[model samples]
Target chain A: MELKNLGEFNFIHSIESDTIYDPNTVVQGIGDDCAVYKVTEGYEQLVSTDTMVEGVHFSFQYMMPYDVGYRLMTANLSDIAAMGGIPRQVVLSVAAPGHIDTRILEEIYRGVKEQCQHYHVNLIGGDTVSIDGPMVWTITIIGEIPQGKAVLRSGAQPGDVVGVTNYIGYAATGLGSLSYNLDGYPMTRIGHQRPEPQIELGITLRELGVHSMNDISDGLSSELNEIAKSSRVSIIIDETLIPLHEETYKLAEALQTNPIDYALLGGEDFQLVFTAPKELSKALENLGSITLIGEVIEGEPVVQSVTKAKEIRLLEAKGYNHFHE
Target chain B: MELKNLGEFNFIHSIESDTIYDPNTVVQGIGDDCAVYKVTEGYEQLVSTDTMVEGVHFSFQYMMPYDVGYRLMTANLSDIAAMGGIPRQVVLSVAAPGHIDTRILEEIYRGVKEQCQHYHVNLIGGDTVSIDGPMVWTITIIGEIPQGKAVLRSGAQPGDVVGVTNYIGYAATGLGSLSYNLDGYPMTRIGHQRPEPQIELGITLRELGVHSMNDISDGLSSELNEIAKSSRVSIIIDETLIPLHEETYKLAEALQTNPIDYALLGGEDFQLVFTAPKELSKALENLGSITLIGEVIEGEPVVQSVTKAKEIRLLEAKGYNHFHE
Candidate 1:
């Protein structure tokens, strides 16, 4: 199935169902801040890793080592959030050129440690090797998802309402700011350099029984498609109902591109996209900041838009592909 | 401080110890073939990650993708073994160009899966992306170690005999064969291609009063230096007692390089270098095809000649350096 409309969580949830063995050991697998496994009876373990490279995944003009460190750490923490896990330790294996400053290396580690300490995750073991070209860093994170519980990405079914933790397309807007010259968008620079992972919301959602879930790294549509494929169900998203920040809308309007397209296809959002049964949906209504976007359906894999004139099919995959140009 | 001299297990152990928090649930940390944690009372989880790159770390000319897969998988398995853990699942991340063959990729994964099944590990999740040049593959291994009994590299004390599970310097010899035209050294080629990780020996050592230990990756001298640094003890080696394979010595003789130096300085020998008390050392006298290279001391690190009339001190800290051209 295509990755676009299904979204990151859905893709992960589908994969998680088939991958999780020794379920009793995996307190939670895929679809949360991180994958939570019980390391022992009383304590929990968190694991997440991210790969960042030049040209394909990122560009040199837009990224620095410290920024790389910050983003990589955030990616890992996002995994921890998806699992309702709290991070405690991390190991970084970074490959770069020999001439990169020892301080720059220190800065990368410092950024990583800063995030870890912020999340209460400690900086531990790592390997630093010099390479000739673009730099590549992979950080493996270990955290605790809490005892006796973990949030999975495969629990959503029909009659469940779809909800998102924050306004989508901000990171994408930030990307637009990087790729093209866009002005007047606040936090666009910060969003590109220092995207945040929603850890608290992930735990609350798990405790509140927010069914199937995932983080929005591969754009909103891609994540939804993943959940749909994994749960073997369909999702219907309201095109107009998707919440977009004024910055994102303004940027899209300036670029002459549809804001809905950016919301649907822009990646690196790192927000939570979850589904919950109708009965449990009310718990999230007034609980905090959230936006109700759509609902689950029982049919073929497709995200249909609900509108007055006609229901539009928006299920075609529309984000990044490693192999495709 | 450099990776080449740090050795794998010692580096990982340092990271594991410093990184983990509320590690009550961690059945096993670093020092094993994988990191094992209890997800629940009834089940356990394992996780590990290995990164391989071109030119600096490996050469495509001498190593096939299948062999790369084998070596990478073995590296991950070594982590699991160090923890006294069993492998359950693995996630592989690869960065390569689109033109790479599907069959080669399948064969690589086939080798990985074969080894996993052989060791009772599973192939679970991973990321794949295209890069500008050279293929870099990173695999994260998940495993299970028993509760309360994982080994540590920092557990060694003085008065312990330094033991090596098998012959050292083969992998480095093999690497030398590829680049230096070592026609006489048939074994060096094998060493470069398929170095074994002493998985069984690692698990067995955990029950043998073994103290500080690490894999002999960056030469015997380099690994010994790490054990000395970490356990805060000196290790004195009897130079004459060191083991040297016939082919390695033959090649070294042809090249005017001392076979002893090659054996001592060569890296990528994935055998276990560990310490045990005198009684346990004697018990290991005829255990298997192994080597009792030296003993842990109280004062300073030294490798002295036992046969020559005048004692010759071995060169200090002159092993492989990844950063050195």
Candidate 2:
């Protein structure tokens, strides 16, 4: 059935039926003007919003409705992870043409429900509106952390060691493989379609005394540049230490581009990039699959790369430009 | 300058400069992956999100960029007010065509900043993306109320008096005047263009022991119908007691329509419709410009209206349907 025929309230009721129950925090959900929740005492709140517009963020050619909803939730969850917080609730607003089938929206909501159940988050409240244009999804996530426990990008010190949770360039390579319909790159394809938010890894890092952190959403160079600029410290990464999946190299070779470039400039990795004191470097490494790739230095707010040939090269603090694209 | 030339980051930076300072509660704002805030120890958090799509909610023909931003914020704030909550922070996501001028966005942000400062709410983090279609603005508001003190629509008991803040029908008449370029309805035009959310009135009502409450964003009949359904009570409104502005009557006559119909089915009034016990009716009257227009009864969930001649008429729960519109 089309949305116009189903009407707005019935369509909303259908989606609300599958909301994850969270009685401990959510006082009211879905039906009220505002969703009320009890804030855990002695904890701070964290909020972040992200928007995905059709034709700009994704195309129907490469992504199904389920993928779009799942990825949007993943992106918002990654923001909470970057803050060392546990996500608790989300409000999603969607705008789509009236001619669309109701089942498509139901599938999207099902994807959202799957992610919320996986993360133990509650779907609190949101708005659904009709548009005359392409579909647009905007999600706002609310999370909580212990008071004064949030690790900000401004906390890194001059001599801190920079580390990342996983290999980079996989998501970018996944996009490339999907775009060209290349075979034999399941890891990259899954990476782009369903990137995982490092929520547990972030909390562990915070407990491990990581000074500063960010999620790698805008590629390695741009993420590093943000850390450096916010903390007012110079950062230099060793080219040999940067981890890239083997599939990334193959895809870059097929596309006639450098794998390092993809690792540096491609985005949507959703891995945690953080800094810790040198004394905690061994502890960080022992905790998980984290790689120490760089060091903070006392200088201007710039990011540099030490090439394999032992020469330092300046890296431009540029990433995916949405408007330009 | 077009947004394409300014790029996403710089456009964000331009708006970041106008954020209101809230050092007491906000630990971090705008720059990080997530905005961080300290929650009050004895309060519950309230969250609500609303979206406005270009050509669906508003058009440049009827609204300036400033009005669009201001109205969107008003809509989100009204949701919090309906729950007797104090709005504190907001996250706004905007998706627009790349060819739109940067000054227009700046003006919109300026209007947003004006409202934030007026309400003492801080601007938190959000996303800005380029869309190939119409402009869409989605705002999420985070608010707070004393623990277990929020007023829900399901709390109204039989024999409670239903009341409303100020006169209705003005907004619907205002829309008509604006659309037809009719003069002599300046009040209606301003009412439609810059509707105010009754935040203070809501808090006062909650303090005065009001049972149920809702903001009249979808006309009086629709709002009353929701309350009746949620509370499982019948509501009977007195047509003689329903307040209508003189300007509304004049405009309705000019358009050959009944002003009562406008009051019943026209939306975007942003007025408060609530219920209070009979003993508290005097207290509600003393509080401000509140009018008691109806009474709740133990019956099927339906709304009826009583004419001056003692004739009863069933009222349809019809209001603004986003998809149908």
Model number with the top TM-score: 2
DockQ of all predictions against the true structure, Cα-based: 0.16, 0.86
- Could you tell me the TM-score of candidate 2? 0.98
| Native A-B contacts reproduced, model 2 | 0.91
Instruction: Find the 10 residues in a row with the least total lDDT in model 1 chain A.
Output: A27-36
lDDT of 1 at A246: 83
lDDT of 1 by residue, B99-204 (tens): 6665566556666665765775544334556666666777776666555445545556778887887666677667777787656666767767766666678767
Off by over 4 Å in 1: A1-46, A146-149, A307-311, B1-49, B80-89, B142-151, B177-188, B301-310
After superposition on all C-alphas, the RMSD of every candidate to the true structure, in Å, is 10.7, 1.3
Model 1 chain B, poorest ten-residue lDDT window?
B27-36
